[model samples]
Target: MTTRAWVLHPDIQTNRDRKDPQPALEEAMALAHALPGLEVVGGEVVRLPKAHPGQLFGSGKLEELRQRLTDQEIGLVLIDGPVSPVQQRNLEKAWKTKLLDRTGLILEIFSDRARTREGVLQVEMAALSYQRTRLVRAWTHLERQRGGLGFVGGPGETQIEADRRAIDEQLTRLRRQLAKVVKTRELHRAARAKVPFPIIALVGYTNAGKSTLFNRLTGADVMAKDMLFATLDPTMRAVDLPSGRRVILSDTVGFISSLPTQLVAAFRATLEEVLAADLILHVRDISHDETEAQDADVRRILSDLGVDENTRVIEVWNKVDLLAEEEQLALIRQAERREDVVVVSALTGLGVEALLAEAEHTLDEVRMRKELILSFSSGKQRAWLYDQGVVEAEQQTDDGFVVTVNWTQGQARQFHEL
Candidate 1:
C-alpha cells in the first residue's frame, strides 16, 4: 500500500537516456493519488560511485534512510532498478520493510492487467517464477505436512506448508499446461507455414499505439487503452498488403525500459511471436522524449531472445503527426540510410499506405533463397514446393524431369528428397 523506494543513481552519458528518476518518482506519486489502496509516501536514492557495489548506501546513509522511513511510515522500499537478490534481501532486512524491485512491480502490474485466459496463465507463470526465487521474503510461519490420514484431525485445519506444497505441484502442472499450449501453438505455426503468410509483428513500448495501428490495418476491435500492458495476449489478424497479398499482423505485449526478466521469459510465448515474424516492426512513439531509449531497451531484449541482428526489421516512427516540421524532417533524414523505415501516425492514418508498401517489399525477403532440383516423377511433390515459395526455374529431362525450385530452408529440405 505504501513504498519507501530506494533508488540507485549512476552518472553515465548516453545519447538515448531514459527519463530521469524524478519523473518516475512523480509518476509514482500520481499513481498513489489515483489508486485507492496505494500510497508512495516517500523515497530515497543512493548515488553510488562508478565501481561501488557492496552496500548501495554507506552505513550513515542507511541510518538516515531508516530514520526517514520511521518518520514517513513507509511500508515498502521499492528499488527503482535492478538489484541482486542478496542486495534485495539485505536492503529489506536493513530497512525492516517489504521490498520490491522495479521488475516485481511491473510483473504485479501485468498480473493485474491480464484479462484473457492465456493472458492470465502467462502472467501467473511469470509471477510464480519470479516469486520462486524470493521465497525468503515470506512473512508467515511455516506449517507442517497435512494429509487425509494424518493423526491430526480437524474440520477447519489450515496448512501453510501443505498449501505451498500444493503450489509447487501446481507450478509443475502449469508448466506442463503451458508446454501443451506452446506445442499447440507450434502446430498452428506449422499450419500457418502451409498458408505461407508473412508475419509482421508490431512491437514497441506500452501505449505506443500498436493496437491502434493493428486495428486500422486489420479491422479487429482489440481492446486498446492509454494504459500500461493494455494488450497482454498477442493477437494476430490477417492484413491485406498494398499488393492484395495477405500478411498476418500480430499485436504483442508492449516493451518497457525495465521490463521484468521473469515477465520476459513468461511472455516468451508472446515474444516468440516476434521471433517467428517475417519482419519486425519496431514501432516508436516519436512524440515521447524517451522514444530512443525505449527503442534501445527493446533492441536489447530482442537480442537476448536470439533475434538476429541482421533480421529484416522495419523502424516505424509513429506519431509523426504530433511532431513539428523540423523534427519530422530530421527523423526522416535519420531513417533515410536505413533499408526499411517509415514515419506514420496510426491515429490519423497518415503514411499507413506507404508503410504497407514497404511491408510488401520486406515480406519478399523474409526467407533466403535455396535452389533445389526435383525429377519429373515428383511433379506433384514439386508443385507443393511452389506453395511455400517461388519457383525461379524449371526444366525437362529425358531420364525423368529436373525442376529447380526456390524455397526456404525448411522447404528446400523437404524438396531435396521429394
Candidate 2:
C-alpha cells in the first residue's frame, strides 16, 4: 500500500507560541519513516486568518489545498491541529481523501507499535473511542465480517449496520478486558505493599531520552529511540541501587501538550503504573526552548491525575549535552536553589549517579518512622518484621530488641498487627 499525507493546521491570532509547524511536519515524516508502507508526499502550514466554524479553514484555502492535493496525488490528509468531528467529516468530503487529526495520527502510530496484550488493548480502546465520536463514512467497511474474517476494505452486503454493531461489540469486550487488566494491576499493587520498595517513574515529553536512561540503568533494551512515543506500553525493570537495594523503575508513555481525552481515558490501565510509583522522575529536555512550559504542562497533567500530593517528584533536567558548559553551570546553580530538582545529561551519563543517590536518599527519608519493641524470644515474629519493613536504626538489648522501622504508614499497621 502506498501512503502519502498532506498536513493542515489552523491557528488563531494568539497562541503564537504553539509548536512550530515544522516539528509536526517532521513528526509526520518520522512516523512515516518508522512505518514501512508510509510515504509523506508533501505538507504545508495553512494559516487560517479567520476561523471557519464548520471547515476550520477558509473555502479559498481549501480550494488551493485541493489543487495541491490533486497535483501531489496525496492519499491521506494529516491535520496537525485538533478538529471537531463535524469538521473532520466535512474536510474529508471537501478534500476527497482520508482525513486524520493529530489524535488519529497518534492512535495509528500506537496501533501499529503496540506489542503486548495490554498495549494492544489500550491502543484499540483509544481508536474505538475516537472512531465512535467521529463516525466517518468510509470507516464503516472496517467492521463487516465475510468468509469468517473481515477484510478491511472488502465490499459487504450489510456494511454499515454490521460494522457499527461489530464495533460496538468489540468496544464492549475491550472495556471488560481492560477492567480485568486493571484488576490484575491492582493485585500487583497490593503485592508491592507486602514489600514497599519505592517506585520511580520516568515521565517526559516523547523523544526526550527516557528509554535510553531506562536501558542504561536497568540493562533492558526497550526500543530506545529519538522518535516520539517510542514506548507506548509502560515497561518496568528492577533498578539495583548502589546500596544493593532495588526499586521498581517504570518507563511510561511520554507526555505531550493537548493529549486526546479519549487516549487519556483509554490508557488508564497503563497509567495506573504511575499511580503506584512512590516517586516520579520528571525527565525533561533542558536544552529545549519550551522546557519550563513543558514542565508546567507535565505538572498540570500529574495534578489532574491526582498523583501530585505527597509524591516525591524530582524534576530531572535531561539532555544537558545540548547545552554549553556555561549554560550547564547556570542550570546546576539554578537546580541548587530548587528543592527536589536536579540537572543531569542522560546521554553522556553526567550526574546520573548523583541523581540516583539523591533519589534513594529521598526515598529513604520520606518513609514513615515507627518505634516497635519486641521480646528477644519472638524470633520468627521479629524476623517477619525485619523482612517486611526497613530497619532504619536497630538496637538489640538483652531483655528485648528495640528497633525503629521506617516504612510507609500502611506497613506500620501491618507490623503492629504482627
| Top TM-score prediction, candidate number | 2
lDDT of each: 0.70, 0.77
Candidate 1 clash pair list: 376-401
Write model 2 residue lDDT over 261-333, tens digit each, in one string.
Answer: 8888887678767766778898998887777767887887887776747777888888999998999999999
The per-residue C-alpha lDDT of model 2 at residue 158 equals 50
Backbone clash count, each prediction separately: 1, 0
TM-score of 2: 0.81
| TM-score of every candidate | 0.76, 0.81
| Residue 61 local lDDT, model 2 | 84
Which segments of candidate 1 are over 4 A away from where they belong?
1-44, 49-56, 70-75, 83-97, 137-168, 365-369, 374-389, 392-403, 406-418
Which candidate should be chosen as best, given lDDT against the real structure? 2
Task: Give the C-alpha miss distance for residue 191 in model 1, angstroms.
Answer: 2.3
Candidate 2 residues lying further than 4 Å off, grouped into runs, are 14-36, 136-165, 370-387, 390-405, 409-418
